[model samples]
Target: MKLSSFAVPILSASTAFALSKLPRPHRRAPIVHDVCGSLNSDLILNEVIDSLGRATVAGHIEVCLCLSDVVKFVESNIVAQEAVKLLGDHVKVEALISGMITGLPTGSHCSYPDHARALCTDSNPCDFECTDGYLAFPPEKPTSCKCPNHLMECDGKCGHFKECPSKAPPSRRGNEPQCAAGRTMCGIPGTSTGQPWKCVDVTTDPTTCGGCLNASPFGNAPVAGVNCEDIKGVIPGTVACGNGRCIVKDCAEGFFVAPASDACIPVPEYATVDSNQQSGEAIPGSAGSIEGPKVSRDELTAALKHGAGIAIAHFGGPVGGLKTPRDVTSGIQHGTGVLVKPVEGTSAGFKATRDVGLAHGAAKSLTAGHMGAFAGTHGIRGVDGGLIPGAGTCAKGV
Candidate 1:
């Protein structure tokens, strides 16, 4: 090999001056090795020695003994004589140099995390290399590999790119319920019977499911006991707070529905008598007390058909409704028109009792064109919530 054919591309004169000061025993005097274009070639120990007269030339060789040529100049003293064997490595110049100079990988896939270890091929290039799940970064210097997508590095291995792995739970935005005024019920993830979250229960919203909200458990959660059954098909007659928590009250035996009080009250002659029924017991202008047998459901029904009104004279019986709901032959009515507290929250208000002042004289008859004209001479006479027309005796709202 012609040693003169090699060239160095040194960076600074000072670097070359510093390296040229090495002792060149006897083969020279004060060896001010300029390391410029010079003449010095020798073939000894079967190892070739090239000229190191220049620390900076033009071609492949960089500093006098750059890493690229470390393997070629192997004679123990040859490094000291020909070049600064290895400029950067602290190891002995003799050990650092090798005879093999095969370059890095040339194909893309043949590349390894270590550029020097990568295999060169027609397709793969050894200029850069990165482990799986990582990419070469910084065009200026790609000696290091970085995991993309901020993924965690595990066991010296790069995990999935930047993306987080799926955990046990898929994830949800929040505990928001599926329906308004309801709760969101969630089930365990990845289970056969695990159900998706949905809205349920009136325990959170007394308005829903007829006060079912009252039966709700912790934080108004939906449970099996929360069933609003009583007010079932009661549409306009719908499930109401008839005594609350979907509990509907029944009439005490004989008292039919007064039609007014979604409540049930006692019949006129049941245990006592009102001072209104026609009696000659003589209270003068008063209807007088009735000391007789308990009026039957039929009698009340008949009176209801005859423009007779019923009002809750007083409150407090052991019942919840103002009067108490009765099982009228007519039907149950909604809006009990009584003041009762509902399950707090937004609907915490009162329901007033319906008014029953006079009999229609005839159902909806304004023929009298008078205010008190259709009213019964005694107490309120028109039946509540009923329009018996010519029959005139429907009493309501007891």
Candidate 2:
């Protein structure tokens, strides 16, 4: 307390504390993680949004360039993840990157105003003048631009630009005039503008069969046109336009062209003979309309063939031998005999029969007789042996 050796040190420490408490010039804190910090992040994001707005107003190419710059900055700085998090959705980030990569202008000559001006200088000044049939682009670039009547340019050399080819037929360039050879300019119905017309080949265009069938180009009533490809029941790729008319070359399965008509009609189901030799035709009974179950021709054929085979096999061997050519021919008409018992002493007969039945069932018609014979042939003689009842009859039981 009496001015010892620590007295000067204590005075200096107090003075330093007082100075620390005094107000001083403010300084910003160092940014952490670069622009990932909230303040810097928002500032960069705002700058990007502003640039995008200006670029959009400028044109498509400008927007592309702006997006490309943003992408390059984010990637080069290793902050793509941070940018995506700030954007709040990876899809938006992906879309931005995609837009930057695709649909951008190509070639070296400049068309953008700012870029074109950068290429101009005192020594290599812009001509702002071009020969007849040619024009100065950008009014700043020194390059002389020329293109055909169908071409155009702002500040760079002109060239033809076409849309990607389509997969369908009648492939042609999108920039080509629709009213070229083999095509007619037909006005769209309900449209007043002459520019709303479409070009089509009325002679071969299936949709505009005969002429501008749906258009009233001359201000008259629209001509009705048939879309041949839209004809019901006509096989796809089988209908065509000929001489301005829809010509159906073929009808789809289960359909037929009615006599003296171009339309397709369903095939009529015919009546068949039932038990007691009665025709299976529909009739109006007291209760209601009575009709027999319809059988397809294919089904009937398969049933008859299956039944005839069983009958022949049962009778051909022991009941009566094939003594004449007619008997042989009749047996031949039917398919191979259905086996009632497996071949004796063969270990594989049961498995082989089962496999054959499965194969035939999938590849061709499998009837009750086939299943029953398959079981019985393998010496199976219980309920399983009669897998299907009425194994060898041609009636509905089959």
The best candidate in terms of TM-score = 2
Best by lDDT: 2
lDDT of residue 94 for candidate 1 = 36
Q: How well does each candidate superpose onto the true structure, as a TM-score?
A: 0.19, 0.24
Q: Give the local distance difference test score of model 1.
A: 0.32
Clashing pairs in 2: 137-154, 137-155, 138-154, 138-155, 210-244, 213-223, 342-377
Query: In order, what lDDT does every prediction score?
Result: 0.32, 0.39
- Per-prediction backbone clash count: 52, 7
- lDDT per residue as tens, model 1, 242-348: 33244324444555434553434445442222333223232122132212333456665555553344322211112121232344534112211111222111221
Which sections of candidate 2 miss by over 4 Å?
Answer: 1-182, 188-195, 216-222, 259-261, 269-398
